[model samples]
Structures are given as C-alpha cells and as structure tokens.
Target: MSKKFLDDAYNLNSSQETQDLYQDWAASYDDEVAENGYATPRRVAAALWAHLPEPQTPILDYGCGTGLSGLALHETGFRALDGMDPTPKMLEGAQAKGVYRNLKGFDIDDPAPLQNGAYSVIAAIGVIGTGAAPPETFDLLMKALPKSGILAFSFNDHTLDDPAFTSRLTDWVDTGAARILFRESGPHLPRQNLNSDVILLEKA
Candidate 1:
C-alpha cells in the first residue's frame, strides 16, 4: 500500500467520503495501522481498566474500525464489549475477531447509534481527528450518555495540533458538563514519532 492511503485517511469532507474510504481500507486496515505502531488502543484500554475496572460493564467501542480497539479491551479482560462503525466492511472485520458481543453500523453524522444508558463507557480510540470524525461528534456522544457515563478518547499529534480540539475539550471541562478523570500523553505511532493524549472523562 502506498503512503497515500495514510494521507487520504484524514482529509475527509463528507459522510459518504468517509464510508467509501473505510470500505476500501477495511481489509487491510489492521496491518496498515499496525505499521504505525498504533498505541492508542492500548492506552485507551488501560485508561478504562484503571478507572472503570468492572470487567462486565457494557462498553461501546465507538468508531471501532476492524475491532482493533475492541480486541484490546477483550485482551484486557473486558467481556461486555460492543462495537459500532459506519462501514459494513469494517464491521465485518470486527465481527471476525469474535471479541464483541454485538456490532452495529451507523454513521457518526447521524444521532447516537446506541440506545440511552446502553454503555457505561465509550472508548473512542483513534476515531476523531484530521480526516475522520469531527469534534461535534464528541458532543453527540456526551449527550448520548446517562449521568456518570465515561467517555474515553485519544487525540494523536496530528489532531491535537488543531487548537480547536484543545479548545473544545477545555470548554466541555469548564462548562461542568464533564470532568476529566485522567489525561496523559504517551506513545501513539512510533513510526511517525507521534504522541497522543488519552483522556477519560465523566458526565456531570
């Protein structure tokens, strides 16, 4: 695969564009991202393990793409994992992992795909940023949660460089809609020498 795949991964303009892009990338998405030494999966899983610790609580792997993040959660001993993605091909890849109890397909631009109070924590690893999910999706996820819901996400160097992402997170914190439980910067993709901040927040 050419580096253009990596370049095109971000830079998306519409829901159709994102669906088409992932559909094409779904088969090799795991290997391609693995080359970058994708670290967010482990980081997000660790954050959840540290804070939540309940192995049986329902967890939704938002933007789960190929079930990579869900697999990580399963490996961390989380059994009630469910995954959601917009691309069916990617969902198929996830299904093959046998990690999630359920997998659904839904566009992020649409309303929250899951029912209210469906999950105790939403793990959004390597989902939003650059050419992918918009920051507005974050608000939607927050709204989908019941009180005390946990939202764990990560922003790579590419995404965090955008001041708006930083600003949006800060605004959510300042407004008292959520409180930051844990935040730390660590390895993201060693090949790119990039780092990301993994954050865990609770709904107020």
Candidate 2:
C-alpha cells in the first residue's frame, strides 16, 4: 500500500530524478494511477479524435508511460501509434500492451529526440506538469511536427497554477506558431480531486 512514487511525482526536481522515479514505479504505475481515477489519457484521446477523425493518422505518444494513453488512442480508432519514453522500464510495460506499432526509448536530454514530420499527431498526456517535463519540452514537441500537424497535451491543475507552464502554451498561440484547436478542463484524477486542461494545438 505504499504510494511513495505517486506522492512524489509532482515534486521532481530534475530529469534524472524523474527517470529514476519512474524506473521504479513502472510496474505499479497503472494500478496506482487507476486507483486515483486517472482521466487525462481518455480525455486527450477523445479530444484529438474530434479534430482528426482519420483512423490511419500516425500518432506519437510522447512520454507514454505504460501504454495507457496508447490504449485510449487505439480504442478511439487510431491505427498507427508510436510510443517513446525516456525510461526503458516504462517502455517495457507499454510494449507489453501490444498497442503501439513502434516503441523506442530515448534520452530525455536529447535536444531533438523526435523526428520532424514523422508523426502527423503527437500526444503528451499527463506530461509537462509540475515534476514531469519542463515547459521547454512543449517547444521541442511542437518543433518536431510539420506544418498542420497536431499536438494534444494536458496540464494538470498543479501545472496550470504555474504561469511557467501555462505561458509556454500561450507563447505558441500568441506567436502564430500554433493555434489552439480544442481545450477543455476536466478530471485528471478524480479521487485526488485533481483537474487538468486537455488541449489540442495545430502548427500554423
């Protein structure tokens, strides 16, 4: 009944810390998050589906931990899915789900880990939060996309409260780099009373 990792997930200070934490938590990550009623993955999947209904669109689930997000996308009818995570242990869990067409592990510090225009759609659900990916990660994800590509991501209440996180999003839209296609605030983890904003952005 230990919830150490979940409790400290949002307080991570560095990429190393985040990686180390997930390496250990990967095995129980799904069950632990489920107990809290994790909802961002489904919410993000449905929002992306609304904008791009094509079942064959290629999708990159960045920071896809344990394949829950991949499952949601698959259930929503996306046939092509590629998952990438910095933590190999988590990637192993994701691989076991048999949802993704391709899966790989990359160093979180790599300046441009994603291939440009490789995926028409990218998802970063439950990433880019207080103790997860930093604000700059948003720019990296967006830059990897081709013009007209879509990026669907979420910012939990903790991330929303910090302008550093919210500002990165505004900077993109304000600069005409990307346009907000869909944004809705809803449950992230119901049991934790947490809420998150699921957003879809298309490169201009």
Which 10 consecutive positions of candidate 1 have the poorest summed lDDT? 1-10
What would the TM-score be for candidate 1 when compared with the true structure? 0.94
**Tens-digit lDDT track of model 2 for 1-204:** 665477799888899999999999998999999999999999999998888899989899999989999999999989899999999999999999999999999998888888798887999999888989989999899999999989999999999999988998999899998999999999999999999999999999
**What's the distance in Å from true for residue 155, model 2?**
0.5
Model-by-model lDDT, in order?
0.85, 0.92
Candidate of highest TM-score: 2
For model 1, which pairs clash?
Answer: 10-131, 11-131
Residue-level lDDT of model 1, residues 1-204, one tens digit each, is: 353366687678887888889899888788887988889898889888988788898988999999999999998879999899998999999999999998888765676566877776888898878778877777767777889999999988888998767777888899998999999999988887889999998999
Runs of candidate 2 exceeding 4 Å displacement: none
Please give each candidate's TM-score: 0.94, 0.97
lDDT of prediction 1: 0.85
